[model samples]
Target chain A: MTSILASAEELTGGVCCGASVAVPREASGCAMEAVRALVRRRVRDLTLIAVPQAGFQADLLIGAGCVRQVEAAAVTLGEHGSAPRFRAAVSAGTVEIRDSTCPAIHAGLQAAEKGVPFMPMRGILGSDLALHRDDWHTIENPYGENDPILLLPAITPDVSLFHAPRADREGNVWVGVNRELLTMAHASRETLVTVEAISDESLTSDVRLAAGTIPSLYVSAIAEAPRGAAPVGLPGYYDEDTSHLRRYAELAQTEEGFDRYLAEQVIAAPAPA
Target chain B: MSEAYRPEELLMSVVAGLLEGARHVAVGAISPIPAGGALLARERAAGRMRVSILGSERHTFFTDGGRELFDCAAQGRIDAFFLDGAQIDGSANINLVGIGSYPRSRVRFAGSFGSAYLYFLVPRVILVAHEHSRRTLVDRVDFVSAPGTSPPGVYRPGGPVALVTDRCVFGFDRAAGRFSLSSAHPGQSVGAIRDKTGFEFTLDDAVATTAVPGAAALALLRGSVREALQEAYPEFAEHVLGQAA
Candidate 1:
């Protein structure tokens, strides 16, 4: 049965230590609240699979020492600059980095979504990204002679987490135009989402909203956390809190500063109502 | 000609010039200059060109998700794309995955985004690196996040066409696997660019000076283009273009 929780902390209970967690790319629609909850829980040895890319959320997890590994195309703060904690972690050899490209990450998830062992993809032929990843195999095309292609093994994450605009009581999430969230949900064993509000009416009742809705069947849990994707923004709902993010970028530069940020913003903060 | 322009505006003009004939152009994340250039090109093309700037609600048309961009590029729908690197070699090799050996590094950069895939699929890839020096333009990249050139039988239709930096523009020849000094930016000499660059490149005797944006171009940039760009890059529009978002 799908778990409908009232708080972000409760929604994060489904996540287990050492589990592989898949996250979306864009700064917007990221499960920042749930990430904080997870950080507070001190979930350890996590394998973070960024759908294609990552931003502040990945950095926070790495900073909190929750992630053991990161598999993504990139982890940056975007305009704010490089993700400080992520950079520090990589520099200190504290976290294992499994480098991947954008399309390859998507293809791997698509493979999982289709229940395939692997998916064939173009490019990455001459890249060191291909060279380093032993699991990514290169095989000659069976139909076309002498044509070699790279094959990525399915990336079936244990959990997929993100934020959205809203969800119905039935757990149907309205992710709108961020369709990669759908791919993440379909590919993972469990999809945990935090939304701005819990709609009493069914999202699928309307034809327009239904087109972008993720059916309740795919969602394992839902939490109502208003302004949940703060600092990152939630597309139409709000703009990015750049000042806050810029402050994070500066504070997260050092270990001591990061710890203080956790203490003030995360640990001491009141729990979601 | 008398009007002054910021360095970013100058770079934007150069990028716009490179994207002249492209039907569809995609700008990746955190690339305000390329985004500006694409917007400017779209304005000049009279809506014939499609500009997709990632992270913008107004600019992008992709509803199928992040993978759609890569899919579109592979199908040859995208004509031009922009890429940046922490280190770019003479051969056009780009390194986004930090300096030093693989897995471990002295200076770890933001890992390669989609360069490995898009660099091969997009026909015209413009390499943009604002910091043009020996440190950035290395003799050989420590890590080839996306190789500039591929061996035979490697199906590659797209690779770097040119590299634009603060100093000058270097036109890439895929057939020769080399870069030739195409043009020097205003007030920059060929000798000065050579001194700053670490990688080797052929310099033609008649290297032209990069044309600065004219009054009309500047007007469009500071007006409509800057306004359009604000949605995605408010800081860039405000500080770089000197406009309030």
Candidate 2:
């Protein structure tokens, strides 16, 4: 049975120091409230894996000194410009970066989803991205004539965290078109979700919602946190708080500014209702 | 020529011209110009062409998640895509990783998104760098996020076909692994482009001026294209396109 928690802090208790956590991109719902909870708890040495790419959430974790390493395709604040904290950390050599291409990250997670040891992929043959990753292997296709392919090992994270619009009483989360959350759940040891609301009705019972639902079998716990993906949008629910994000981008430019932001936003912030 | 257009409008026109005949074009994040171009091309195609802008709910149709775009590209479903880098060499090699050495970079740009894969799978991978300078258009990138050309025996059907910048257009030759000056943008001279470029490129004796966007194209861009582009890039639509549109 999945544990139904009352708040983001309680749900994030499972997240310990040095745990490998996989998170969704900005387009898909991000677990911002959980990130704040982790920061408030003063969690350290996290290995953050962006499920292809990330933005504000990744930068926040990096700035808060919660992350020891980052494995992602890219981290940028989009139109607001570069992710200042990530750039500063990378330049200062505070965080180890395992640079990856978008598809390679997906391939590795998919490999884990299928319970496979490795998945063979195309492209990345001559890239320095390939050269840097020792875990990635090149193998000749036994069935084809002189064809070489890249094999990526499974990427199974300790925890997969994300925000969603809703979850049912049965703990089935409605991720809608954001199917990467489904993949993340399957690839991680435990799946923790924070939702805008909890429905009394069973999601799997509804035909339309069932298609986009992540069954309770994969979910370890659920927390009810309204506006959980704030600053980042939740598609139909709300638009991205761009002004807030832009302000964050500005404040996160320097260590002093970042510490000020952490104190204002995460540490000294009001608890979610 | 009757109406003055913004530089972004010119760049969008160039991008739309490059996207002609592309059945399915996919634009990535932070690419308002390419997104506008793709939309403009779609309008021109009478909805025949499909344009998928990442992060746009109204534009993208990927229900299977993040990997579906890559999977679709691998299956040859995508005809055209766009990429940019911090440093791009003459051979079309892109450096999206950073400015300095690997691991410990002096300056780090965003890591490579899908460039390493889409640069190989999509038939037309157009490289767009709005900044055309010696620093961006380098002799050799410090890191190769995705190589412009692959060695023999590699199954590569896709690579950079053209490099578009603010000042000019450079057509890439896959066989020779080099770029040639195709056309110079309005007010930009061949001599000026040569002076600014850090890498060497073949220049023809008669370099033509890039065709200016016609009234009809500009009208479509300002009206329908800008309106549709707002769904994805409201800031660009509001600030860049402005009330004139």
True lDDT of residue B127, candidate 1: 96
Q: Is the docking of candidate 2 incorrect, acceptable, medium or high quality?
A: high
Tens-digit lDDT track for model 1 on A204-238?
99999998999989999999999888768777888
Best by DockQ: 2
lDDT of each: 0.91, 0.92
Instruction: List candidate 1 segments past 4 Å from native.
Output: A270-273, B243-245
Worst window of 10 by summed lDDT in candidate 1 chain B: B236-245
**Interface C-alpha RMSD, model 2:** 0.7
Name model 2 segments beyond 4 Å from true.
Answer: none
Question: Model 2: how far is A265 from its true place, Å?
Answer: 1.0
Residue clash pairs of candidate 2: none
Report the error of model 1 at residue B214, Å.
1.4
User: In angstroms, how far off is A253's CA in candidate 2?
Assistant: 0.7
Measured on C-alpha atoms, candidate 2 has an lDDT of: 0.92
